[model samples]
Target chain A: MTDQNGPQLTRIQQRNRERILEGALTAFSANGFRGATIDQIAEEAGLSKPNVLYYFGSKDEIHKTLLTALLDLWLAPMLSLDPDGEPLDEVLRYVSTKLDMSRDFPRESRLFAYEVLQGAPHLSEILGGRLRDLVDETVAVLTGWIDEGRLAKVDPHHLIFSIWALTQHYADFEVQVRAVLGPGHDPYAEAQVFLENLFRRMLAT
Target chain B: MTDQNGPQLTRIQQRNRERILEGALTAFSANGFRGATIDQIAEEAGLSKPNVLYYFGSKDEIHKTLLTALLDLWLAPMLSLDPDGEPLDEVLRYVSTKLDMSRDFPRESRLFAYEVLQGAPHLSEILGGRLRDLVDETVAVLTGWIDEGRLAKVDPHHLIFSIWALTQHYADFEVQVRAVLGPGHDPYAEAQVFLENLFRRMLAT
Candidate 1:
């Protein structure tokens, strides 16, 4: 997709815009939508306030862009759940990808978590449209698997919720997780094995 | 225990203090710690800022009191895990109580979620000491059950973490849960049955 100002933006402008977004992601994930400020985001980006504003127009624009981008990345794993693949294997692969995201992109997980916790005011429309559509499509595929006796009967939606809750827990609540697991504990490794055992038993037809 | 200023407070003072804490829970849960303010808390409590301050020295005092109280409540479910009872029953009962808390006290859940997401700055001490101790004791009981072949062999710590992750997700991400589940859906009712089935199969000896 071409940018609305495609022809006008120089290479430097595009680079600076990406820089500001990276900075905003860090600041917003740490401070939340209400707590984060434009000044703090500018400092994080290593750009002056004027420069930050010149690219993004306002703090809200920067935040909406960051969240929109993050949502796309977050949903890619689920969208990759192929109907042609073995049902349980496909679901487990999706789970693995989600856990990898938690490990590799914790800031993004917390940012989404914070938004959802705050009633999803910033992303309600997107949640209702894109997110809802994706989930509905996935649920249909899971339901078809169950109907063919390819997997055990269960609410596909709730199963999806469980996968999300279980994987994302390691990232969004890292402090509590680390405190409980103690120092030097590897949670992702344990989680991978545990969840596989769980879903295997759960999906055994 | 006496108040720092001595124990001469009237009944009204105690009631007013409780009101302030309740108000703070709503504000803090919605906006998180840094985003919330004394003026907002005071307004939510229907008290003047000076009056709210008179009862609690500062916003920090109010926050500390709220957190300490919530920690006690949060730990109560874990503390109720009985060693002498049927091991699986005890665990399921603990799950039920946690789900009940999520349904009844979602704000408390979000407040804790926010604190943990922010590295648990206000909760680190309690999480490290009180929470760690309780989990250790519970893990021992679970280990005992596994040793006796009364339950399936699993890492007791990871099992406990899964319980927390699964149960709390309903509360911490209520909006997303509701949105996906759609209108007229009773998530708690569905969750209760779903969890029971998952744990029953997982724990079958």
Candidate 2:
């Protein structure tokens, strides 16, 4: 069995893998890891259960792949936080970009939110290693901005947490947001203006 | 089978009921609703499974009771948003109370967070009805403050959302918070000062 599965994938393998992942994200995002089933993923992907298992050894493997892919997409904005750029403008841009992602790609946002809510059991390694490293670098960059008088001195970790909380609120709490904001109100538009003004005022020297 | 349940017991019934709920909260918070079981709750409460079921008809009933109780406790501070009080102060006090709850009643907070993270399937009725109504009233009060020139004109709903996001981050993301903040940092004290400055700056007339 091990020897049979040793080699790299062909184009058919790549296509089937993509199909399975697309379906898995939807199921996992909506039902959570424990609540989701491989059969459901198979049906959603329009593939047989064995076929699904053929691409990935188990549900755990598929989940890890999805999470790793999401981590990259989710971390893109933070990775773009330029240490040399104008501080306040850079922060505002980050906030706006994050809010945009929340609006445009709510499923991916919710998937990340779900994993983190579950104490990130599957992604603990990623959180402990990759996420921790990224955050440390960002905090160091933020501390430099503060020391240079380019930004107000605040706890860099908490500042990042606040930014995350505010931006992800629109996506993670969409039901509440939509209900309270009413059907007609555009939350993203208001969120953009509110966040820009908020970060600008909060970080003003 | 229906008659087997019989009438409720005297003092013992109430006492055991409370014990069951307390134990369930710990289990449910730690393992989530799906991951938890009556056996674990029974073991935690020092009662057998049948004895636990005697008080609550099913695991779902126990979970519902805990959720209902938590909703009341969770909404207490928001309920105290006196329309006649100073707007920013009322809001600040509300924020502080929530932060305190996040610290003191973290398990309860996590239980609620877990529910919402799972799409709030079990509690959506209460969330959509009672919780929604309470937020509406709270938003009206904030809007009144804005209209009266008592606070900076801002989107009241988003304002409330921001307060919730900022405060709950301490508890809901406790692992991440500690990991990033380091081993010795006191998140609550720093959060209090940071939040005070944040709201003060945002709401300053």
Candidate 3:
């Protein structure tokens, strides 16, 4: 999708952009940004190198585009935490939404993980600025709930960290998880049940 | 350290080997296996390229050596989860030890994270075999605790996953954590307090 000030991309152009971003997600997630080449991304996208370049100026641009979009998706669950909603219920809803995103968007989750793992060079500002502001708001919300005895008292920042860690593990560490658990188990479904119980037991007064 | 069956190397040989592995950890942790080269690892280790190869046959050998050591350290926490100890205390100790590892051995943590995130190509056998077996034993120990009314009723596997996800997050996502928290916070110390409370609350019968 074009920015409001930009001219509209043609339908085909939009599709190609989406395809490039999708393939770039695969490439970048599997290989760190430095390791992934433009040729590899184009190959993964089923497009020629020049074709990929024609759509995005360079690998960095493609990466920036993906990271920008991913940051928004990454923030959605935290952004949706309703201060007006029941405290425990709202937190659970946030956890559930994040877990669903991990299941539905494992590539995106790994992309975020990879970026952050490489020192978040592309994301440091957003991590400190946009993401921080939202977490600050969330911290306030959780603190208020805890102070009111509407939820069990816990450090708000660490609580947020815990949620991120628990949900993203399924996506970022799927191999170890699968290897450890062996075959024939539904990880996401089981994780949902386990996490819900764990959170409820942790947060319930 | 030399293999028990092998003749011991000189002290200088052992130190150089440790240097190479340490440097390899930094390189591999920052840039996944595909991205890191032996030259880069040599540079990180402060040794010449030929000097580096003199100790290890190749980059793959160096990476393998680092991971083999990492997996042992990784398993140390879980392996020490004593079956005969107080169930709650044993679980809490496991959490504390793991969190300590995340604090003290962050690079090792990220090195393992990178390997797993990249599908554990070199580690599939060990993951599916040794690590899985260790987790199986851990699951049995946890099940025994819960069944004996010594611990809360919870899925042993997911419980172990939670311990992993929660503790490892502090290390694997250190950049994001620091960015969001800003300056002046001793993250590991704060994490320890929060996680101790979290597990305590969640595990109390």
Best by DockQ: 3
For model 2, residues B60-170, the per-residue Cα lDDT tens digits are 999988888777788788999999998889988999998999999888888887787677877777776788788999989998999989988777878888988888878
Superposition error at A200 for model 3 (Å): 0.7
DockQ values, each candidate: 0.77, 0.50, 0.85
Rank all candidate structures by their TM-score, best first, as comma-separated numbers: 3, 1, 2
Q: By DockQ thresholds, what CAPRI class is model 3?
A: high
User: What lDDT tens digits, residue by residue, belong to model 2 across residues A125-204?
Assistant: 77768888899999999999999988887878888989998998788777766656666889899899888877777888
Prediction 2: B-chain TM-score = 0.93
Clashing pairs in 1: none
B1-205 per-residue lDDT for model 1 (tens digits): 2244667768999789888999999999998988899999999999999999999998888888888877878878999988899988988888888988999999999999998998888889878888988999999999999999998888888899888988999999999998887789999999998888778778878
Q: In candidate 3, what are the lDDT values of residues B1-205, reduced to their tens digit?
A: 2353566788998888989998899889887787788889989888999999999998899998888876776788888887889998999899999999999888888898988888888899999999899999999999988988988888899999999999999999999999999999999999989998999888888
TM-scores of chain A across candidates: 0.95, 0.93, 0.95
Q: Could you tell me how far off, in angstroms, the CA of residue B41 lies in candidate 3 after the best superposition?
A: 1.3
Candidate 3 residue B185 Cα shift, in angstroms, is: 1.5
lDDT of 1 by residue, A31-99 (tens): 898778889999999999999999989999998888887777889899998999999999888888899
Residue runs of model 1 more than 4 Å from their true location after superposition: A1-8, B1-8
Instruction: Give the docking tier of candidate 2.
Output: medium
